[model samples]
Target: MSVYDDYEMTIGIECHVQLATKTKLFSPADNDARDAEPNTKTHQIDFGLPGMLPVLNKHAVELAVRAGKALNSPIAHVSRFDRKHYFYPDLPKGYQTSQMYNPIILAGYVDAPLEDGSLKRVRIDHAHMEEDAGKLTHHDGYSLVDLNRAGTPLIEIVSEPDMHSAEEAKAYVSELHKLMVYAGVTYGNLYHGNMRFDVNISVAKKGATELGKRAEIKNLNSFRSVERAAEYEFKRQVDILERGEEVVQETRGWNDDKQITISQRSKEDAQDYRYMPDPDIPPVVLTDEVIAGIQSKVPMLPGEYREKWSALNLDKSVINSLLSNQDYAQITLEVQEKSGEASAKRVAHWFASALTASDNDTNDDSTQTMLYAARGS
Candidate 1:
């Protein structure tokens, strides 16, 4: 047996999901900056101008409540924000407003379904509200900072180190993304930075009591990248240990072209951030009525739809294709309710065939045609 066979890997993930709010987290700036000029979407609060104070956005809180219901977690009636001090060119405020001691969403768990029809339960430690930093672009000799993305509302979902393999990590992220999207919490556009993942990976000897030092791969935008990075990092750590060296605890970056992890900087502890309660913003206090009102807006989740469609006995691939788009899943369910099981099965097969013919293309035109066809029949 290979030396690598005697080792085990552990992984945890932190995801930053941008809330689909109309404005920035604490300012009246335009939230959608896809095609705007570099700094046009920023406001005084985002720029951290003097004498500027942040006003809490109620819509963001409403969405967070919906998110809590989707995650099968409880919403904290009282949660406060703190200041995480760090220096970076993109952070105009020099400190990020986040939840450190108390977060909005409490402990939760996600039953991620594996390919073999087994479920891996991943525990969520917590999810906190925060604002995003700006984008930095490096040129030949200088770097440009764009504040367009600064101060955008985000909920960072942090999971426990419960995942044991790369496949589990991928499955967990995919389920999390679906939950967020189906709940109408965020746009769930991975390419547009609506959701970004930071994967923390560690390796240890089989049956060892303690886990090895971990290296975090930051800002991964795709699910495949998460799985590939974990696989590479585990091997890298195992090789280091076999050579009588130790794995360094640091932040790393994924080279998608090379399929390798590169060290970026040493990881810092919480004390390094100098966390302090924010003096400007007050604590978020929600009543039972408010939470119930917001949570009522949450739509059917992927798991619920899967359970509803399980009676059809369709292939797993077909079910996954239907669940790819919210409309498709909803239509399939509606057909089952209106017509009968046989009709719904036919509709499901039609959607699966269309998706396969289009190479799983989810473009608006194709989606519209499918919706029309499903409605007509």
Candidate 2:
């Protein structure tokens, strides 16, 4: 039997997404911290002032509901915020306001594509709303805190341990990222840390009923890192098992430079965080009319766009490029509407070429305007 026959890997991922809201989750401070100076976007509420109160952002909730719809998840009409106590320099409040017992989004699954051209449905355990902590930058011997991100809105999507391979893990995150971005829940920018993935991996004997000790790789910023880290851990754990060694249950960090996982600390359970219902913030009560309104505003997702563009018989790359970008997809639809169905193929080619020439600059309003003019011409 092959060495691989002796072991199987089980993987689950926790994805943290920064909501695309204009203000912080519980404060009126600006939420977009991309290029702003450190700590400049913070407010008194973000700093955990004694008298400051937590106010939920309505836009953030609407975006969360939109995301739930996109994920095929049921949205809870009544969701409450709790306080998760923790101590760190990045967290000024000592406790983060989050949803624990009742999350906004319920169980859902993402149909992720595999490398073998097959689909696997990854079940989502839950998606909970929370406030993000600050950023800590370490200098030579000191560290500085940036509270700009402290009160930012975040949704942590926890997945069931259904993925068995690195490809599945990558695909699951990729699909999740696409859905969140297309649904306008988040910008899904890895560079700005709009989304981060925490991968929990474990191994088992081919016919074992119970799973082996698992290690969580935290804060993986890219899909490639998730794949590589999973693969690396799989082999590492198998090797340990071969030597009659037990895998340690700990939290690890992905070393992109070394392409390996480094142990961070022993994993902590939920009780360690001291979760308690927050008395300051009231439970969010959503009426049927409000939920229906938000659902109505949900746009066509990437999967729908794919099905629509596939009928055009255009190249798969072209179809995917357009679907991956909202502006490109809008331009393609406009072209088909204004120039008739016959002009769609030529316009798709031109649009793909322009996208390539423009380096896929989605922020260029002028380029989009020109495309509209050309389609009308």
State the lDDT of candidate 2 residue by residue for 31-122, as single tens digits: 99889899899998988879988888999999999989888898998999999998988889799899999999999989986656568999
Off by over 4 Å in 1: 356-366
TM-score of each: 0.98, 0.93
Tens digits of lDDT, candidate 1, 227-262: 999999999999999999989999999999999999
In candidate 2, residue 298 scores what lDDT? Answer: 78
Error of 1 at 193 (Å): 0.7
Candidate of highest lDDT: 1
The 0-to-1 C-alpha lDDT of every candidate, in the order given, reads 0.93, 0.87
Candidate 2 lDDT trough over 10 residues, lowest sum = 354-363
Model 2 ranges off by over 4 Å: 337-342, 352-358, 362-370
TM-score of candidate 2 to 2 decimals: 0.93
Candidate with top TM-score is 1
